[model samples]
Target: MDLNKKIRVFVVDDSMVFRNFLIKSIGQSPRFEVIGHAINAFDAERQIPQLKPDVVTLDIEMPGMTGPDFLRKFLPKYPVPVILVSSLNLRVFDALEVGAVDFVRKPDVKDEITSKQFVSTLLPKLLIASNSRVRMPRGTVSSAPATTMEARQLQTPTPRTMEHFAGENKIVAIGASTGGTEAILDVVRNFPANMPGVVITQHMPAGFTAMYAERLNKILKMEVREAKNGDKVRQGLMLIAPGGYQMRLVKRGTEYFVSCTIEEKVNGHAPSVDVLFNSVAQNARDQAIGVILTGMGSDGAAGLLRMRKNGAFTIGQDKETCVVYGMPMEAYKIGAVCQQAPLLTIPSIIYRQLGLLTK
Candidate 1:
């Protein structure tokens, strides 16, 4: 971003108090300029195109026209990044599917601590959003594995399809932030249910990870859930690191389990991808495949490089397919990634590298 030009932001919320709070909070930032505010989506639509703000902070529960509805009708005509500020709920994902760049959950109990916490997260997201790619109705997440295979491969793997799948003791570790929710789902949904157990760290606030895990479980063939302290890393399961915790890979007597604990935030994120990837680098070593997906910042770059140096294959999402092109770009710059591929092709790339897919 040009230093001379401050990031222009537009605020949209139903509650006057909340709207004023946003305006006041954002106004304090020298990097951000609150160009305008709207009490509803209808007003926002009218003002946004004319105002042409760089970013939009929206509340999903707006009266008359909801956030998702507005995104559906508005984004195509006037492309702009939108950050949803919503209470803990699944509807925010609906907004995300429609093209919202990111979301900040409303403080459960409005207080000094909560407000500061909210801003600390929101400001960085706003910075990320300012540089993010706003996909119109975002690409449809591929459910099929990226390989030439029959449906049986995903459900019940045959001898040929299951080649190298058993006794491999390999695992895939994925990390993302920003546009990660759908991206993570996109990659994992393609894996066979028998694929080696995978772990993921997506930067999210506390309380949302469980919901995200539950949502992923419903959409995926493999079992998905938020990681608990002693959750085993086994075949056919995808464990998402719970928010507000640092999850590490622990090897105990030929079995792998996760250790999740409340810890100091790393790289400005509680569930830092670096922390997880570093643990994988140390524990899983050469038996891991590290994937850094679409996200902002350099959280996973160092850890990914560590994984690569330790003989683990690492992949970064290519710039063309990334939302912010920050994390993967940083990783690629540092030679941490063995290869960079488009988002949709990454699953196949992993499988191919593991000799699980045909050329």
Candidate 2:
């Protein structure tokens, strides 16, 4: 936490070559100090308590005790922030749900270009993870994770009525970055299948959003899919902005649709929350609800403010529940949030906004 002290890092991977490469590259950074390296979970478990690194880089696939399993076992004891270094593996999301803070996709092969790309992704992720708080590895306190139906029952009123919501053509715009994956799930899982259209922009890469959308569709009651060039924003459907593309809301008559474009990164992310929020501000005005969840940077602050100024209902995740508390904090500071609540409470707040639920 001291500004003068470099962030301590521990590297864990089964490949000796990859481990050394990480050490050599990460050691060169002025902001980081590679305190230790481990070739497997057992090695990491032995050294991590003694080293107490600010952040740990772990590979998801190893000889034994995979990264998620390691996190499942070790995080309850040590509680150090962890970042997963992986390829196109969905198990990284599993680790994140347990305790891992973030991840960087490994390049296909080790080369100069891939190395540079990996470092570019890893550094900021590490910075965020080093500062992130681990709260009992996320799912431990709950006997089992809440299903979408359970969350819906808890957060909304009975009978699952959409009479008001569908007629009004309301849209919900959500944005988050670092700790967004699970945070978004926590919030949206609470919504009933008949709720108004919802659009999300979580700062993920191109390949991952598709997988994320697929996972969400399977678990959630409503239809959830990655946004395309001209996807309608309608009731009982959630559209996630494609990674590496900027998404904007456009109104056609009384209905709303999304425009996904492969544009330059805004605020350091391609599917920038600002881009989506700003568009929602313009198109939906008072008909929309904007929610900003936990994230690492100030991406959605200005846009949320614009939404509030245009009479949109804006909610922010309170600091106590946030993993990083950066994006929502910025939005709150700028008078953007009409109500600040915990992650699980946001969907009910949305229902209240639409008069769907009294509480």
Candidate 3:
């Protein structure tokens, strides 16, 4: 835990080629050292005790035991920060729910662009995971609810229609990173299928946003999809800004839509929350609701402040419910947040603001 010491990393994957690639790529960085490599969970379980790595990069589809299974078994006994290296699939979220810190989409080794993208994404995540406090799986924490409000709300189907809010052209803009996958899900899933249109920017690498959106669509009543260039922003639909691209809200005539473009990293993140929030400030103004969730940086703080100055309602997740408390804390400090609440209460709070429910 010495601040001066290089972060020691353990790489776990089934492919020998990938293991070597990771070792070589990580070796090039002065900040990280690949202390050990494992082909599967069994190998990792044995070597982890001796190697005592500062961080672990895991593969989800390994033979014998999958990544999620390993986390359920290992974290309780030997709590260590785990970063999942996965394909564009739902398994990554499953791993996060079980206690992995974050994930990077697996790069296609044959493609040069993808390989470079992998390195750009992996390096920062390793650093973040190294400094993070790993928590026990939600299932193990008996004091808190195992299932989020979204899941329970879905069970008793509410047939609320969007007809009443037809005149309110409001949009919700959300931003998150670090532990945001589950945090955002907890908020979005509770939203009624007929709620106002929503847009999100989650700090994720290329090829993962589509899958993440698809996963949310399956559980939530609302239609969720990865934002496309010139996609119309409409009620009951949630557009996730595609990873590696910047999404901005633009008004055409009386209607609003998003313009997705590849741009330089803003505040050290592409698909940056700042980019999305600033756009909302310019376009939606007082008609928008901005929410800053758990993350690791100040990317959205200034943008949230801009939105508030422009008269948009803003909310920040309370530190007690946040996995990192960095982004929301920064927003709160800068007077960007109009209200702060725990994760579970966010959806209801949004509904109250929109007049969907009596406060």
**Least well predicted 10-residue stretch by lDDT in candidate 1:** 151-160
lDDT by residue (1-359, candidate 3, tens digit) is 57678999999999998889989999999889999999999999999989999999999999999999999999988999999998877789889988899998888887889899799889988998887768677667445554664354434322345566742589899999999988888788767777778999999877789888988999998899999999999888999999889999999887899999989999988899999999999999999999999889899999999999999999999887777879999999999999998787787778777877643
Tens digits of per-residue lDDT, candidate 1, 212-265, equal: 999989898789999999999998899999999999999998889999999999
Alpha-carbon runs more than 4 Å astray in model 3:
108-117, 141-162
Q: After superposition, how far is residue 26 of candidate 2 from its true place, in Å?
A: 0.6
TM-score of 1: 0.91
Candidate 1 has which clashing residue pairs, if any? none
Which whole-number lDDT from 0 to 100 does residue 79 have in model 3? 91
Off by over 4 Å in 1: 108-110, 139-168
* Candidate 1 Cα deviation (angstroms), residue 117: 2.0
Each model's lDDT comes to 0.88, 0.88, 0.88
Poorest lDDT segment (10 consecutive residues) of candidate 3: 152-161
Cα lDDT of model 2 overall?
0.88
Write out the backbone clash pairs for model 2.
Answer: none
- lDDT for 190 in candidate 2 is 56
lDDT of 1: 0.88
